[model samples]
Target chain A: MSLHDCRKAFSETLVALAEADPRIVAVANDSIGSSNLKEFKKRFPERMVNVGIAEQNMVGVGAGLANGGLIPFVCGASCFLTGRALEQVKVDCGYSRSNVKLCGMSSGVAYGELGPTHHSIEDLAWTRAIANLTVVVPADPAETSSALRAAAAYEGPVFLRLSRMPVPDIHPADYRFEFGRAPWLRRGSDVTLIANGTMVARALEAAALLEADGIKAAVVNMSSVRPLDREAILEAAVAGPILTVEEHTVVGGLGGAVAEVVVQSHPARMRLLGFPGEFAPTGSPEFLFEHFGLNPEGIRRAAAQLVEESARVAHETHPVR
Target chain B: MPPDSVPTDAAAESVSAAKMARRIRRSALQMVHAARLGHPGGDLSAADILAALYTAVLRIDPRNPRMPDRDRFILSKGHCSAALYSTLAEAGYFPREWLREYMKPLSLLNGHPDRNKVAGVEANTGPLGHGLPIGAGAAKAAKITGASWRTFVLTGDGELQEGSNWEAAMAAAQFGLDNLTVIVDRNRLQQGDETERTVGLEPLAERWRAFGWAAREVDGHDLEVLIRTLRAVPFEPGKPSCVIARTHKGRGVSFMEDRVEWHHRVPTAEELSQALKELGGGDE
Candidate 1:
């Protein structure tokens, strides 16, 4: 399978957008190479602002640019951009409601060898907790391109987490992105596997494995985590037990979001799969995913266990049926 | 907008600015005293600079606070919102009666200045080191679109320790943001102690210059000097401007001036009366 980096899609979409709209500007904290904005800078030098490794100032400058009638895409490595400048993101971008697109490049455990300091596993929790901010994690290059356009069209703060690690394209070239809706990738009646970002492709693989074992499974691509697709989650709940997977911590990423919806509207048996609450050790991105049980085989095993648990509970509740 | 084109009646303008400063100081005192839970020291210290900008320096319209071309002013040291509110009210951005609702539950006048709630506020800022970067962004935007409007940001001396300000300072110079100006309310004292004692910020003017800004020092309480210095912005062409205004933490009040404890100290009834008498007591 040919692999694609989502950050490339993000940068290409941003440059294409900038070509059409003069209001589009790219602001970074000296991460031009990491953010893949060198082409953008070369095309529009004046519109590119490189603030030299200052994450907090980068976010604030993005807000100020938005206030000055320009749409600024604040691009940086996700760890520093979201962690170091969390307060600024909360106040300047989130609370102030600035039209700033925070492009968190290399999110999740993409920088695996760089250790926990460079990992942006907490970005989803940090950004989603803030009010008036949209959080998105695109599963593929096509989805990344569409999400970038959607973020630009939406006139408010948005956190777009783009992966630097290469992964196979899961969405077609003509995929249309929606802000708060999940696109069902595969349908089944036995169990549903919910995931996003790098884990969405893995979830599809897990569902195929379940199909081989005569246990049909549904797959959902939940990219928009903040304004989660409640209707999809409720629908999945009625189908079977849900197993949420992500390239983030299980405490407050996709799993937490799904659990909140299920507990509030429709209670159902579920299994949350991701990094356990601990600092990830040094390894490659693939190694970290395998170590955390975020690979297809791991997801398949978790889904199988959840299905069996759901069947046991159902039988205990209504034995005659 | 010529640098030296001070109004022909410069002396009259100075006197009026001085009077406006006094009014703002008194209004801030009353607002803080009414709330009994607000920062008064920085409010009193920032009065003269706020008055000068709102009255003479900034190109703003009270009726059209959202004018895209209007000059941008951000209060980075948002704990002193009482002073900003007083100045905005006196400038007719909103009714003077709204000052009374400051810090009240569900009131638009929050403990911090919220741009969404207040018409004249450019940004919601309570966190330090945020305004300068935003100001830099606005200035960069002006440069991008070839807009003539300038951006001004007021930050407390102690607020400069956040490191984000230095980041903005570098970018402001790198972008050659001649339209941007940063004013530091050098009120020596902060919450715990003097700024120098808490974190040494001495030789601050040279620091700004080192960051590629045209740095200047001025007496913050002097209205005439402030208006003149502010009008002569981009003190040097092609560089961002920095005004380090030396000020007493609690100006106009003898007991509160330069006192560390008065940073957020609410005045007693006796102290309020004494302050009013010293400020030439008059109701808004």
Candidate 2:
């Protein structure tokens, strides 16, 4: 499979959408080169609003642009776009119901050397909590195009957390995206691995490893965090145990969403995996993933352990059905 | 601030003020009763000024809410939604009877002003400190388009504590948005307590002057003064305008006037009767 960064895919998809719809406008906070929006700005200068270094104004301006009958895709580094303008996003876009697309580039430690301040680990939790906002984390290039297309088609505010990390394309080029639904990658009876963003790739590797160890692991890519895929989660609960992983804090991220679903639906055995609610010490993105036990080998071990635990629980619940 | 000029008694001024104030109070009560659950106290507090604006000063069209040449009004402190809804209804943007479905699950009359949901609402603002920047942007839009559609925003006194407002203030002055007008509802009490105890803006007028705005102070309940001052917008050329309106928390309702507890408190049957009588809201 070809390798692609979701940020490049986002830029290309946005340009294509703009070509088709004149109402589509791109707004950046002095991040033309950083958000990969140089070509877009050059092509449509009138539609590009480059508000320099002012993230708060950038978000409010995006809302203003939307109010004026234009659909705005507000692009910037995830850390500043979600952190600096968080209140603006809540009030101007969410509360106001402005038709704005918040494109957060390089989320989840993608800026490897930029340290914790520049990393956007809390974006998922932050955007997910706001009412009337749809939070999306695209796993790879194909998912990125799908997410962008969905965001453009939807008539509401959306947050698209794009990654700068290069990843092998997991979904086929013809992947059709459905917002707020999980994409099932495999079918298994022992356990299910639900993930999004960069963690989906490692989840796939883990599933393969689990199969090698004579354990079948189901892999589900849960891209939308808000209107979660309750149906798929219920199916997984009925099938076997469920394990959730993400590139964010385990406390209130994807794992938390899965736990919420299981507690209400089938009440299956579950294991939540991610960064253990703490900032990672300085390291490369690859090093950090390994340190947090998010690599494929670690995920594989976690999946096996969950399967064994689920088997034990199933035996205790119904000795002989 | 025109050289600290004295108040003038222009012909037809007092009569116009009395008429506008009466209409605003009547409209505010009708909207709240229609919606069933809305912030009525703040609506009453800000009614006189909004009445002065729509009836006397602001240039707008009820039929064409999005006219390119029309002036813009942003209610920054949007929790007082009843006031805005009534103003727009009276302005003929929509049927006044539509206020019946306010706060209903499917109704567009949400708890806050949503520009997308409501006609004639320039910006959607429920949170404090969001209006000034948007109003600044609208003013900038006018400047860029070479249109003289002046932009006006009304904010709560307590809402100024948010740093975003100061940022917008600084930016507006920097851009010399002469088409921008900011009106502060200095109602003293916020959701909890008096703004002086919570966060004082005693030197408020000077603060605006320092920020390159032409500043003025007026009795918010005085419709005559509000109308007179609002009519003379952009008091100084090449500068934004800031009008500090001194108002009571609940201006017309005798028992509720200046009472901090009535911020969003639901009125009982007895209290509602007393308020209606105090407001002189009869069968019109």
Candidate 3:
């Protein structure tokens, strides 16, 4: 498995989309270099709007462009795009129902070691709370490109959270991304491990490790956070316990979204694997993943424990009947 | 304004706009009195500018508000909804009867403008400093697609304190959105105090000029001057235009004019009667 930056796929797909559609416009907040939009700007110079270091204005402008019969993909760092310009996102896109695509780059701890201010661990929580928004967290390059196409084709407001962190291709080149489906990557009945973004690949790897220990663990790529795949979550819950891992905080992230669905319907035993309501200390993303037990080994350990807890509780209730 | 202030076309338009402005002020005051909740000060201050833009300058068809070539107007000082709704009603966007439902429970006429619910409303704006950026984007779209319509945004004087406006101001110039124009209601009063005492936008025109726009000041309540200034687009060929509309908060009513408390204070029956009498009687 080789690591590939999802930003490359995002920009390539965006430029392709622009070439076909005249309505496609890019609104950047002086994040051309970081967002990997140089190619896009080179090809569609007039189509790209560099708003010069103002996330609030950038979002407002995106909303405005949508109002003017143009589709605008507002790109910026996830931290500032969602955190700093939250009200603009809520009012302009959510309430106004503007047709805008917000591509939040460098999500999660992709900017790890740059400190918590740059980390976008709280983005999913903040954006998920807003209505009229479809929040997507794509795992790899193929998934990222598919999500981008889906976002442009579907109207209203959509937020695509892309990561700068390199991850191996998880889906096939011909992968089709759906907004509200949780695809079961490796189906097993013992326990279900749900994750998205960078954590999906790790969850799959964790399933392998759990298999080595004779534990048949399932892995579900639950990418679309807002319009959750309730059927898939309920299906996973019916098998056994569920463990959700994400490259975000334990509160209001992928794990929280999954729990919101599962508890209301399935009521399964669960363990949320992510940053537990604390800012990450200074470390590389790889180190932070290890420290917070987001890696294959840690995830396997947590999932195995959850499965045990579920089995023990079942045994106590059923009593060999 | 004097009827003979300009040539026939300009004079006729200004005279009609001046009457519309008067009607807007009267209707807005009555709506505020009916609702028992509104920003009457800013509404009266912005009435003339709204009237001029909606009538004399904007190329909008009240029948086909969403026509591709029609100009766009966004009231950024959205707390002045009574005046805007009155102006829109007077312009025949919707029946004038909707003005009575101003701020009513579950009414389409929200305290702020909603583009989805209201015809002739280009954008949903209530929070300060949002319209210019949206308008700049709309202008950029026209520039991008080679469309022929222009975009205008109206903001309160006190709304300039939000740094987001400067960001928009800089970008509107950077993109050289000549098709876009912003009118600042220089009413000098916010909800709490005078803009001078609060955040001091004294060098306001210079501020816009420094941000790379063709900035000018005008008497916001003067129909002829406001109409004349607004009709001239792109003040410069390459820069965005900024018209600093000098106005007095609560301009139409003598007692309420420039008074801070009237920023959102509801009028008593006698005050409403006196206000109506001053405006040549209300709703008639």
Quote each prediction's TM-score: 0.98, 0.82, 0.97
Clashes of 2: 0
lDDT score for residue A297 of model 3 = 92
In candidate 3, what are the lDDT values of residues A1-321, reduced to their tens digit?
A: 799999999999999999999999999999999999999999999999999999999999999888889999999999999999998998889888899999999999998899999999999999999999999999999999999999999989999999999999999999999989978899898999999999999999999999999999999999999799999999988888899999999998888888888888879898999998999999999999999998899999999899888889989999896
List iRMS (one decimal) for every candidate: 0.6, 2.7, 0.8
Clash pairs for candidate 2: none
Query: Listing candidates in order, what is each one's chain A TM-score?
Result: 0.98, 0.96, 0.98
Q: Candidate 1, residues A101-146: lDDT per residue as tens digits?
A: 9999899999999899999898998899999999999999999999
- Candidate 1: segments with Cα more than 4 A from true spot: B1-8, B281-284
RMSD of each: 1.7, 5.4, 2.6
Scored by DockQ, the top model is 1
True contacts kept of each: 0.88, 0.28, 0.69
Evaluated at residue B164, the lDDT of candidate 3 is: 88
Docking class of 2: acceptable
lDDT score, candidate 3, position A125? 94
